[model samples]
Target chain A: MLKVSVISPERTLFDGDATQVVAPAYDGEVGILTGHAPMMALLGRGTLRVTEAGGERRFTVEGGFLQVVDDHVRVVTEKAATS
Target chain B: MAKGRELKGRIKSVEGTRKITRTMEMVATSKLKRAQDRVVAARPYATSLAQVIADLYTPELAERFPLLRQPAATGPSGGRAAVLLLTSNRGLAGAFNSNLIREARSLIERLERSGAAVDVHVVGRKGIGYFRYTGRPLATQRTDIGDRPTAEHASELVQDVMRDFIARRLDAVYVVYAKFNSAISTPPVSEMVLPVTPPERKGPARDYILLPSAEAILSELLPLYVRNAVYRALVETVAGEQGARRTAMKNATDNAGDMLNILRRTYNRARQAQITQEIAEIVGGAEALKG
Candidate 1:
């Protein structure tokens, strides 16, 4: 499982374990799983999806960045809302 | 009779005032908690942004990004600076607004002495009124931001200033606000936010995959940093305002209580004296009748 945290300026949107995560990078969409190499990508405006053991959670995010170091994925967005 | 009545009236008024102050103190306490929570909520974004910027920033990137580059020298026009003064919208906050205004004034003076033309951007009614009354020029005045400031509000407050800084129209930008150290120790401070001083890189550099290019990312991140800085100042100022207000209202309530105590004592004394005189007069009249 990948440790994931979705943070906005107003509040922390999500923080838990996820099996897979996909985000809208500035250039394009990127997918991450456990043991993904260390990477940092600027986020654009789109829907971010995080897959857990039970189901998938979606967040509409805009203008921020994503960071993956080891198995920890941190998505810090300027704007995000549950969708 | 008149003396007793007047004392009673004074006591009643003092009690009313005490109730108001007590209520205000409670309101301020609750607002302070919310504002403090907001300050904590904003920390994650700020920390993450700082970490990313620190990781991506290099000394060489300064040449490419206008925000990162420090101007070598002031132009013949003499560098321009903007001071964003954050004050409270309402007045019952003890010396909160005044301290912030004073800090902003001194900062503007210092900037002028250093040969920079300073433009004042006043936030809140108190600061706007102070600047207007003093016949000082203000580039912008906003009273819409109340005790609760959102990220959008913060972005709106500093976006123009950031634009001017990037265009070299303004050499530096400073924010004057009460730094919320604690409920009791919030002091007004002025901090330079522009000319983005990248935090020193810590630990060994990680070979992470960069999105787009570092140059492009740094350019975008710099603006976000400025916005975050402004947002933080706004939130801290609000928290400090509530803190100051809570203290002020509590003191007012306490003073009112003490006044009520004194007034009630004086009223009782006057009533007792009146009753004693009435009894003495009746007794004297009865003695005269018997004679």
Candidate 2:
């Protein structure tokens, strides 16, 4: 499991452990599993999908940054809403 | 006695005043709760933004970003500074508006003394009126934004300030407002917002994949961060204003109630004195007639 936190300028959308996560980076889509390397990517306007124990959740995020360090991922965006 | 009648009238007037103040106190209390909720709602955004900045910031990159670089103090005297003052629309909120205005005025004066031309921008009716009455020039007077300030309003202000800053028309931007602490807030404070301060590194640096490049991402992020900062300031000021108003109205109501109580006691004493004099006269007249 990977600890993931999705935050928007208005509020926090999600913060929990997830099995897998996929986000739209500036160049293309990137996916993360449990042991992803520490890296930073610029986010473009697209849907961010996170797979938890229950099901996959999607959020539309725009113009932000995503960071992965020590199996923890943090996504910060200007505007985000559940898609 | 005539004094008794006068005291009765005073008590009635005090009662009316107390009713008005009590209602105001209740209204302020409700407003304060709403403002507090807004402050809470606004917190996550700011916290997240700061976290992202911290996570990505590098000392070398901080120097490259124009917004993160501090303005030179030894620059030419023709440089301009913008001051945005947040106040309330209405009065009777104790020193809420006045204190902010006074603090802003002093800041403006100080900026002028330092050879920077100051442009005052005011939000809310109270600030507009005070600046206008004092013959202080205003670059913008925005009274349309109501008690509940939205992110859009903050963005609008941000656009103008950023445009000026980018064009080198303004050297620095400052915000004057009451910092919200709780139900009670601190005195109005002047905070410099422009030439954004680079996030200090608090934790060990963990490398992240920079898309496009680090510079590209920072270029996009800095403006949004500034806008968020402005939005937080506005929300904080709104909460503080409500708090101040609530405290002021409560004091007014309590004082009025105390005055009414004192006046009622005085009226009762005067009535008793008059009644005692009438009984004494009756007893003395009866005794004289019997003799």
Candidate 3:
């Protein structure tokens, strides 16, 4: 399982365990799964999708950084909203 | 005695003044609480941002981005520098505005002595008023931010400074504001926000995938760093203002109460003296009539 958190300057949009996550990196879109190696990526203006057993959650984030460490993925953005 | 009546009127006025100060104190206390809450709420974003910046910090990365690049020298010809002075719009906040403005002036003077042209960006009416009355040239003057400044306001202010910095017009950017220490104490602080200082690497270095490139990430991260710094400073200044005001109003209320106490004592003593004199006159008249 992947623990994911999406935080913005205004508020936290999501925090839960997820199966997979796809985010818009500066170069291109990147996908992260459980047990992925630690990585740091820059986020562009695009939708971030987090998939879980329940459903998928989507948020639009701009100008943020994504960090994956020890099965925990953290998305820290300046601006985020439900998309 | 008429003196007793005068003392009673004086006591009434003092009591009225005391009521006003007490109410101001209560209002300032509530404002301080709200400002404190906002400062708490903003902490997470700031800490996380700092963590991200610290993790990415490397001397090489600083060289790659102009925002992180430190100039080799500072002289009159080094380039232009900007100072954003944060103060309060209202005057009742004790020495909050005065302290900040004084710090800004000294900062500007020091920068001038070092040979860098400084542009003063004045925020809040108090700063503007001081700069205006002193005939100090201001790059920008804004009084609309008031007591509560949002991230949007911070971004707006940052945009102006960043434009000049990025365009190579400004070599450095600094912010001067009151740093909140406690409800009773805040000190003026001058901080550099531009030519971002990368946090020193600590502990074991963890390898992470750098998407696009380190330079690209720095491009976005550096601006975000400056924005967060400005936003935090704005929030801190607001908190400091409210704290200073709370303490000031509390002192005023306490002083007013003391004055009222003194006035009440004087009134009571005057009334007693008046009564004693009237009693003595009655006794003298009775003795004279008996004689």
Candidate 4:
């Protein structure tokens, strides 16, 4: 499982273990699974989806930044909402 | 007798007002903390982005980029400009909304006198309503900024304005909003928004490799700069609103208390007068009987 933490300006929206994460980057949609390579992306306006074990969740994010390092995906977005 | 009754009604009204003001004060306090938290949390992100832009550019291109370029010699000063005015949707935020309107109106008037066609973009309900009511020209408005303003909400706004500028529709874009300095001090101000230019900063050299060309980076970075600027303004506006509301509510509460005190004094005076009149009548009758 990959660790994921999604934060907005006001509060921490999501923090848990996720199996995979799909985010809309500035260029395109980026899919991250466990043990993915370290990469940085400029987030864009779109839906961010996270799958944790059996349950899945989605959030609408504005623009910000995302980074993947050592099996962890850190998303620092300006705004986000569950979808 | 009527004055006494009026005092009674006034006392009740003032008491009711005190309750509302107290509630508002509490509410504004809570909202201010959240707004402040958002501002603080977003700071690091904004700083990093600025750092990236500073590093990602060659001194030549970054400085000479059209957007980064400074205002031209105003050359007879004949072009039209765009105004982005931000106000709160709801009232009771002190003079936060009105201050913005005042600045916008002044700027618009100045632009008009200078032969600059002004296109106005309003955010929040107060601005839209006030301008429309006064029959001022309005190009666009966002009324969805209620108590909580989100970046996603701001993104759409940023995109719309950028499209206009990029399309050569507006010559310049200025944002009018309240800048929060502290709990007690905030000033409604208009600032240049479009044509992102970081003030001249001299720092150590750091190399950056654009995945593509500098032109490619420029395309992406330009929009990002605009979006972030708008987002920061919105965040600051929200914080200022909360702070203004808190101060206004505190004043309201105090005024209500003063009114209540005045009413109570009148009530006591009226009661004493009635008592004195009764005693006078009784004593006069006793004196007449004695005579």
Q: Which candidate number has the best lDDT?
A: 1
lDDT of 3 by residue, B2-114 (tens): 77788788888877877886788788888889887777777767666777678777776666676765666443355789999998888787888889988999999998888
Backbone clash numbers for all candidates listed: 0, 4, 2, 0
- Model 3 regions lying over 4 Å from their true place: A10-31, A46-60, B73-78
Q: B90-117 in candidate 4: lDDT tens per residue?
A: 8897888899899989988988898888
Best-first order by lDDT: 1, 2, 3, 4
Instruction: Give TM-scores of the second chain, every candidate.
Output: 0.95, 0.95, 0.94, 0.91
Clashing residue pairs in candidate 4 (N, C-alpha, C atoms within 3 angstroms): none
* The TM-score obtained by chain A of candidate 2 when compared with the true chain A: 0.96
By summed lDDT, which 10 consecutive residues of candidate 1 chain B come out lowest? B69-78
Docking class of 4: incorrect
> For residues B49-80, could you state the per-residue lDDT of candidate 2 as single tens digits?
67667777777887777677667743756689
Q: On DockQ, who's better, 2 or 3?
A: 2
What would the per-residue lDDT of candidate 1 be over residues B1-291, giving only the tens digit for each residue? Answer: 888888888888889889999999999999999999998888888888999999998887788887865755565346888999999889988888888888888898888887888899999999999988999989999988887888899899888988888788988888999999998789999988987889777778898988887777777788889888999999999999999999999999999988988888888888889889999999999999999
For each candidate in turn, the interface RMSD (Å) is 0.8, 2.0, 1.6, 4.6
Docking class for model 2 is medium
Top TM-score prediction, candidate number: 1
lDDT of 2 at A39: 76
lDDT of 4 by residue, A15-77 (tens): 899999999887788899987765556777999999988888999997776767678777777
Candidate 4 accuracy as lDDT:
0.78
> Which stretches of candidate 1 lie above 4 Å from their native place?
B75-77
Q: What DockQ does candidate 4 score? A: 0.16
Q: In model 1, what lDDT does residue B137 have?
A: 81
TM-score of chain A of each: 0.98, 0.96, 0.96, 0.95
What is the Cα-based lDDT of residue B96 in candidate 2?
90
